[model samples]
Target: MPAFGRTMLTHWHLDPQVAYLNHGTVGATPTRVLAVQQAFRDDMERAPARFLLRELTGTFPAPWRSESRLREAARSVAGFVGARAEDLVFVTNVTTGINAVLQSSQLGSGDEMLITDLAYGAVTMAVHAVAQRTGARVRTVSIPFPPSSSGAVVSAIRDALTDRTRLAVIDHVTAMTALVLPVAEIAEVCHARGVPVLVDGAHAPGSVDLDITDLDVDWYAANLHKWALTPRSCGFLWARPDRQADLHHPVVSWGRDKGFLAEFEQHATHDPTCALSAPAAVALLREWGWPQVRDYIHNLAWEAGRRLTARWDTRLSTPEEMIGAMVTVPLPEAAGSTDADAAALRLALLEEDRVEVQLHASAGRLWVRVSAQIYNDITDIDRLANAVRQRLVVSSVESR
Candidate 1:
């Protein structure tokens, strides 16, 4: 708010012209952090022998510091969600981490996995795969639109759980609605029924306050690339060390067959640049001041949502308490608007308006979910709201 010292945009190589409101898809890393990542790559290229063999093959300070920084980053994450560092494990992203839990889980014949309609599409496939391997059943709970309260969410999940339910996958923040769910309460409900809850926090890391260890859930994973502003394909999974054995590595990399931490940590060779730059990601959050940046984004999202009401019939599916930085506000669904039409509308926003936002089908209707990050301000969001209203008006007039 203070003279825009720096929007998160300058962090990455994104063009300065675009007003990016799509941090929910994947985060834009800070320019400073990208420099650090390049340095690592350059060092690797200059002398593969010196960097890879002499330095990397053994224990290197950068990666070691990276790992330590991960723990510190984990500490910040754990502090918000209420968890310990040892309880969480860093994986590539939510997809890989989710698969690890599903494939490795000992679910057998007749096991049931309860998920909600709000779950991410990719994660749903993972549950299906688990069901195929074992004769497990997948039950999807349909969450109501314009979510009333966190209690309603908890009740919906509780009603969905049956005697055969062995696992439950929910969202810390629903990808479709961009609404935050009561993960802590959901975990408690699952534990009471002797079931484990796996939370897909795809948008939680940088968008909201996350305390991995204290969340009290059986397993969880979130994308650092989205909210935490890490490089793409960077995310992690956290389990109550006891449940670590419940999920196996998605790939049979070198990390397997080793000890507990070693098994997950030392997995196959990856472009560790993202992991190495994690400390800076965490540092940026602190540097910007987490609470200040968080409130700033959330307030902007609320303002934009309220402003849209004057343009079209709308509603808020994301609750204020549950929502932090991301807000999914529904737009009027044109009666004859086909999927193709919606895609065109989204493209128009990008190509014509230069406003980076999201348009997707959800809750049997289409909605534009607005993500507010540090780089976003009122002007950026107002541009998106105006563009949508303008297009819809033009289409209606043309139809006549």
Candidate 2:
């Protein structure tokens, strides 16, 4: 492993006083890219009418090189993730993209939507909301906390599918447990069953090598803000060319009926800078050799999990091969530790130790997830590991 040292940390505008290990929650934007975003905002502010109407609208009288900023941004992201620009559209985030897909999907009575227990909470709600309104049912697949293998994940999803299952929402990389699901295999199984697959790939964009064409999913959405060096409210939705007919934006705007791409591209009056800034973010990744950065982070995550598992004497939540840039470990159970007690422990870790991490609950158990990114190194993980171990020790003593 390479030391992604202080030089790397200087790229981001993160607080030097805190050990910021929560990149998976909402990523920290690189300062260089943030500067690019500010330029976009400044341009937008300088000529609100000209920029919005002529520039983003793609009506300015200029050469083809001066194309629409929104479209060019989409093309850059599509190229990065191995998809055609025509098939990808920018959205606020993965949650919004999932909402758009679910809202437009023709799911109704007797139809079922299959999802895993590890799905993001907001996406789970989106699935159920559409199901409830259309008299559909959501069948959740209970994947083991530390899944045996990717094959086991595929098998679980395959066994859960039924003839009534109209859609399956799978995570490329899970939110809470941080396990990378076998999305490619799961998509093949669902497609064979005549079920459309929607992948909630919130954490996959820059963390994993993505080829939407290779996955062969009907619809896939990911957040650039999470892994890519982009600011907040940035993500893209990719639909298979054949499945574009089944998709629609949540908001009906001027782009409606113009075409599928048009429908999504022209959301009324929303700032397009987040989407436009994606290329700069992608450029940063290319300049830094993202492949190397991704590998370094993955190694950091795996090592942290190993150290934490040993320190806390708790089970690892996911297997090494299935993890990318994040790992979760169950908190040691105190004699009388309740949900409230776990919440307090999380606050203490942050307020007392200045260490930020995610506390996730599933099946009535609390798990702490640690994320590794370019800005993170061994010291950050050590801080989190020490803070958690200290808290558990104190809680155990006090509980008695």
Best by TM-score: 2
TM-score of each: 0.90, 0.95
Per-candidate local distance difference test:
0.75, 0.85
Of candidate 1, the 10-residue stretch with the lowest lDDT total is: 52-61
Cα displacement (angstroms), candidate 2, residue 290, comes to 1.3
Residues 1-400, model 1: lDDT tens digits:
2334225555567776888888787678888877877887787788765554334423245553434444555565555445676776677888888888888888888889999988888999999988988999999998886678989989998988899999899889888677788888989988899988888988887667777666788788877888777777677787777786545787876657664455666556666667656667777777878778777877877777776655667766456786777777777877224566668778888999998787776545667778877777878877777887888889899999
| Candidates in order: C-alpha RMSD to true structure | 3.0, 2.0
Stretches of model 2 off by over 4 angstroms after superposition: 1-3, 59-66, 335-337, 395-400
What is candidate 2's lDDT per residue for 242-305, written digit by digit as tens?
Answer: 8787677888887776777877876688888888899999988888888898888899899889
- The collision pairs in model 2 are none
Assess candidate 1 and give its TM-score to the true structure: 0.90
Clashes of 1: 13
Best by the lDDT measure: 2
Model 1 bad stretches (over 4 Å) = 1-8, 46-83
